[model samples]
Target: MTTLDPYLAARIHLLSGLDWDGIADPEARSRFDEYGRDPGEWTMPDVDVVDHAAPGPHGDVTVRVYTPPAPAAGALLWVHGGGFWGGDLDMPESSVVAAELASRAGIVVASVGYRLAVDGVRYPVPLDDVVAAWEWFVRERPAASPVCLGGASAGGALALAAAIRLRDAGSLLPAGLFLAYPVVHFPVPALDDATAAAMRSLPPLLRFPPSLIEEMFANYVGRLGDLPPLATPGHAPLGGLPAVHLVSCELDDLRPSADLLARQLAEAGVEVRAQLAAGMPHGHLNRTPTLDGVDRSLAHFAAGLRALNGAGEVPPDVA
Candidate 1:
């Protein structure tokens, strides 16, 4: 029996006490209406928020732009995560993540509202929305606004896939990648027997069955063969990709995917930095209130963006 970390254990207890897991999307949205209200919230005296809309495959996608207290030298193109089925642009966790990145990285943060798969749009739909958002950022913002794309889980997968697409299209590559527990495989591979068994025995955050994962993948892929490599960066050739900063939690079922991608990227000669937050579970980056690991992850994310922008060496404290 693997025990949850003390902080994480308490968090699990708290989440179980809530109605978040079973509520309808609309009802859940109403309950957690504002960003930075839950775990991602940290005190950042210097931060600004603005609402922006960009043209996407699905009409206009709303984006919440986070401006750092300092003058921004660049912008971060951020995608929010919800298993490709849930999440909105202004969700509390996403907002806190964006604001943390903006404040710590000293850059502007554009939180993307990509189309959800279950809500109508499917796999490539999210990718199209990401690309459109990127286009809008480059077209509407300063040419010098170096853009780095990042996201958590599904959003992270989209960032990698989008980067691959941009690279193939001969488009300007983002300065770097900030992937937090990204889903790399399109039909996300099944959890190994050990991982699957462990997950079944763990707390809610640490438990994700292989069967459920298969369902998610099937839903997203939808009987498509030769799905674009841009839909799953792990399948794409790594050559010519930007430097990557990937964060993975040890208790996450997707840690294997992150580890494999990191090894592959490094072997292919991409500048890669992989950090493993031991004992933390999937989406730990969203639990800023209880986990020291979340704060470190955000700080590292900011530092990685800064490094790509020629802002100096990554601060040693960020690990």
Candidate 2:
């Protein structure tokens, strides 16, 4: 049996008994806040990090740019995941991944700070922000620079949706896509027998049941009925898109969705490479990069970005 990493198992044990459904609860929030506190040991490499305002229909969207010291191999427009309700550019999944990719892959990384699905905000708003930021980034970068689009969780949904919009508009499509444990299916696919059995041991906070997944989508689009394909691109047509590099967490409830997407991509004649992060749970990228699994996940993304620039092979450290 594939076991949970000891470090993550211990952390999950500490977070046990807290109701993930009550994330808005003061106690739940407090516990999560404490758990999310990061040590200051992790440092960014020698790279220029800057924040810029990209014009958006709703307002100015924040796009954090990370530039490597040497010439960039390519560029990536990254999106962070929070089930459509939470997450920001400051999250480790966003900022740290951008910094690591910028240094490790020798590429420019633009992390988008799209509006969350809260208050009266609904579908197409966050998508608009990402699209706007992508357009701005494309204009700002060199004409010949190869650019890719990537995201994790809900951010992955947005990234794929944005790509669909670009493709439909006959606009420039990304050279490739890097999706990390993406939640692209609205209903979220059902897990297989072995995977389902494995998920039974996960902490409540780490499990994404079907009901919870549905509720998350409802909150994002304002209703579950007649959902937009772009909002959950797994069921949408997936032809003519660029090559994809997808990471699926072994212990994640959302792995089924990512697996289905891989098959769909193949059926649609799109080149795709999917790798499972063994012994890892969903949102592993949110953890400190010092962890072996986190570093490997980042390296997978770095290798994908490097491939876009015609780099020969995956680096020795990726596995």
Output the lDDT of residue 228, model 1.
Answer: 64
Q: Each model's TM-score, in the order given?
A: 0.85, 0.93
Q: Which stretch of 10 consecutive residues in model 1 shows the poorest summed lDDT?
A: 31-40
Candidate maximizing lDDT: 2
Candidate 2 residue-wise lDDT, 70-147, digit = tens: 856589999999988899999899989889988888989999999999998899899999999999999998978998
Candidate 2, superposed: residue stretches over 4 Å from native? 21-40, 314-319
Best by TM-score: 2
Q: Write the per-residue lDDT of candidate 1 for residues 1-319, one digit (tens) a residue.
A: 4444556554454343234365456644443333213444456447888888888767887778888766467888899888788888666458878887887778888889878888555778888888898888777667667888888888998989889889989998888888998888745555656656656646443455566666666667685467667666798899899888888776777777787888889888998887767566787766553357677777778788877678868544222
Global CA lDDT of candidate 1, please? 0.74
Any runs in candidate 1 off by more than 4 Å, and if so which? 1-3, 10-41, 186-200, 224-226, 315-319
Tell me the whole-model lDDT of each prediction, alpha carbons only: 0.74, 0.86
Clashes of 1: 1
